[model samples]
Target chain A: MNKYKRYERLAAIVKIFNDNPNTLINLEYFMNLFGIAKSTASEDIDILKDVIEKFNFGKLITVPGAGGGIKYLSISNIDSYRSFVKEMCEKLKDASRIIPGGFLYTADLIYSPSVVSKIGEILSYPFQEKNIDAVVTVETKGIPIAMMCARALNVPLVIIRKDSRVTEGSFVSINYVSGSQRHIRSMSLSRRSLKKGSKVLLIDDFMKAGGTIRGMMELMEEFDAEVVGAGVMISTQKPEEKLVNNYISIFVLKNMDEEKNIIDIEISDWIMGE
Target chain B: MNKYKRYERLAAIVKIFNDNPNTLINLEYFMNLFGIAKSTASEDIDILKDVIEKFNFGKLITVPGAGGGIKYLSISNIDSYRSFVKEMCEKLKDASRIIPGGFLYTADLIYSPSVVSKIGEILSYPFQEKNIDAVVTVETKGIPIAMMCARALNVPLVIIRKDSRVTEGSFVSINYVSGSQRHIRSMSLSRRSLKKGSKVLLIDDFMKAGGTIRGMMELMEEFDAEVVGAGVMISTQKPEEKLVNNYISIFVLKNMDEEKNIIDIEISDWIMGE
Candidate 1:
């Protein structure tokens, strides 16, 4: 093939891995697509994986064995992504503007590409093979990660609203507990937002008591959708806080103090040392 | 190119379009990447656009002129996607589960991916080019859309909490007056969450009187982060009540009543027909 063809070949391989991160694929498909020998296709896949991994895109894992397939995790090359996230968190911690007992410049967390990549990686573990029809979360903050999972899985995102307005009329609501807020604010969803029997992945920015997630679960059940997995950007390693299984978290915030400017944050145990 | 190579090329072009939606590009990037001239690159891009648009992945808008480039807009592609979202809203509208006035199946709006996709498309418009540092939302539900937008923009999601807890230590808070929710909530964010001079894309699931988003802006000020743009999933077209600027809403629930089984929904004008 000519140079243009080679570029096209490499680009196509990268796209496939990106679209189907961490999903198993066989050599036959590659052979058919590239019209290359099994050996050539394998080499192409290898080259694509190496370059993508070099860029900190922790996607496209090749499996070795019978019935092996490639899995796209949508993660960054581990160290780069983690370091990027860690840097962001540290910056937030240092910025006195983030007052204690106040809204943690959490909004910043949602927009940082590096941070989102890491969080997406943590979330992929559970939803990798399961039939995830949609990703669900409360709006505003959760939209970022939810969207990531949806793209990775090629699904859609469902949002839950906290207030009832004429715009999202005729909905199902649950009066459970709130997690960080710790108040009895009501959460609502339009009656027809989620399809019945479709499996869903739940995601959020942070999890403290898991009350909001539970409320979401209750609301999700009202639509008859199954909760396939759950994930959060950060989760507190506290007690009585089991929200969902097969979930992953990127980091765990440590002892934090607003006045003295003391806070300890580290990668979550679930993600670190993996 | 081989069959696989062809598909991979298509995927790369699609992914590029996905990242730079509604934008234009020159053939140089592809030409250089593929070691081909503009002629071949243009042909491949055109082919890529046609095939993908057939599937409603998004439309590729080709711009002409010296600075012309290609852009992608995620629109209706999959039949199931649209129907699924509409059905989601319908499910929440079901009568078996009803809440008080002014709120129906709010959860459905927040959780539906199809609906959220529309929301992402709208919200992404304002921050498509700027160096967006983060996507911010008050914790809980906002996480979902924040996730979606972050993924689309390849950013991280940061969440501010309503209340500070023992674990999170000190937090800065602002009183956000909510006319729709009808109460002012003390929203808080951690000191370590944001950075100075950072551009933030603020998002929330619902916009009624705009208290929550406004509160977030106030918090952003405390940290000196630039409020680059703000968007909402649903904006109540209440006359003269503007909560967010440069905003977009997926659908408008014009009418909703719990006992009357009356609910009206329509696509938001901000994004549709654009």
Candidate 2:
């Protein structure tokens, strides 16, 4: 091989690792492949892992076992939700993620797999101890964590859509506050989709004012189903103000918008390690 | 005992099994917990497996040894990508999911660990053979798959926001056709994100006119980065129309639009055993 370029060597290393998802690779092989030292191969993978993570493909697990190698497990963070919310609180301390309408787009907070997994563990904590009829959540973002929690608890999910489609069959309507300042709002879910009297674990993406959860509660009532428990990806408000209590998820920092529409941010109770 | 509900017993069973992660539950204890015949306890678990799988929860596997009762692992159907995608395609076939826009707003599709896992598998395919410096994807819906894929490929994701935010430093601009047949549209990524000459693998939620991939390609050019591969969760147009040829992911359906507005769904060429 007339001197291989940096790109060629990088490609060769990736190919070797890709052939085995969880298999280990040694520096000896890469050194032979690229005629480079172990330091170069190590440097290349380090740079590559950083770039790939930014793409959201996954994280690289570097193992130092007897047969050490890189193992990839699609994890968010270890107990991602917990650590993520913790990270969010720090971001909140910067007070930037605040969206208009007094809501925090801690959607990034939802992205942490470790946090998501931990929250899944927490929400499922109660349900895993019960025979859950099904997991219920509104359409859209909440589906991810809801699905995870529901899976952990071993339940079916009944996702309530905001707009009922023709195929969904007869619809039931419910009223509750939605988006910004808890304005009264209404949405629809097909009655045919939910089984009557089935226990439902209500879920949503976020609860700033807690209106959507209240709305889902009403939707559950319309279907004559019981609200067994509720889980959310994040909650930036107080639990007492809402109809539900002690329902769990992650919380970064809480901030309030005051005069001139300025906001101050701080971490919520969950990520304080409580 | 005052007779706990089926959920109560199921929860107990799950807790006992899960506390061990992969431990087996004995039949003698099953008979004691439900106070029912060994056959009845066995039947209940069989039903629960179907229910749990829907949530991407682990399965209640049976072992045939004297100590075997039910062995539960934390593994969801999503533990592997190929099988998970197959499961979602089966769910999409339901007539109830058909809707307007030729778009499938599969909230379940997004959350199903198995589905996402399969999506991860498909997206990671091309990049597996190549050294990927990063995983790049637009935000909102595509985040999960991007995140999961990043997780699998041991990479970090750099998000391309639809609108530029305050934190984004320096920027690269690009344009492409939109799914709605809209003429060349622009999307941006933070300049601080991708380094020069880094190899990027683009991913997105759905592919229609292939504008997003095209846009990403243009962005890669702007950054002087090499485009390794591109993947879509669902490709709605004819494969030939895909601007990026070196790609792999699912082929949802051909076209569901104007003139015809008919729906035709196909599993990704990969999951189809291609």
Residues B1-274 of candidate 1: C-alpha lDDT, one tens digit per residue: 4323444445456556554444456789877665666777778877766555544455666778888877665553334245554565565446644456455445545544445545565566557667787788776655666656765665556777776442344568888777665786788876656666788889877676677787888899988998887876656666346655655555565656666866656655533443
TM-score for chain B in model 2:
0.64
CA lDDT scores, all candidates in order: 0.64, 0.60
Q: Which ten residues in a row have the lowest lDDT in candidate 1 chain A?
A: A95-104
TM-scores for the candidates: 0.56, 0.52
Q: Where is model 1 more than 4 Å wrong at Cα? A: A1-123, A130-274, B1-7, B12-98, B126-133, B166-171, B225-229, B239-246, B272-274
- lDDT for B8 (candidate 1): 47
The TM-score obtained for chain B by all candidates, in the order given, is: 0.69, 0.64
What TM-score, to 2 decimals, does candidate 1 have?
0.56
Using lDDT, give the best candidate's number: 1
Fnat, model 2, is 0.04
Lowest-scoring 10 consecutive residues by lDDT in candidate 2 chain B?
B14-23
Candidate 1 per-residue C-alpha lDDT over A5-107 given as tens digits, one digit per residue, 9 for 90 to 100: 5455665555555545445678888777767777777777776666555444555667789888666666553454556666766765564434445434454
CAPRI quality of model 1 = incorrect
For every candidate, C-alpha RMSD to the true structure in Å: 8.7, 19.0
Could you tell me how far off, in angstroms, the CA of residue B125 lies in candidate 2 after the best superposition? 3.4
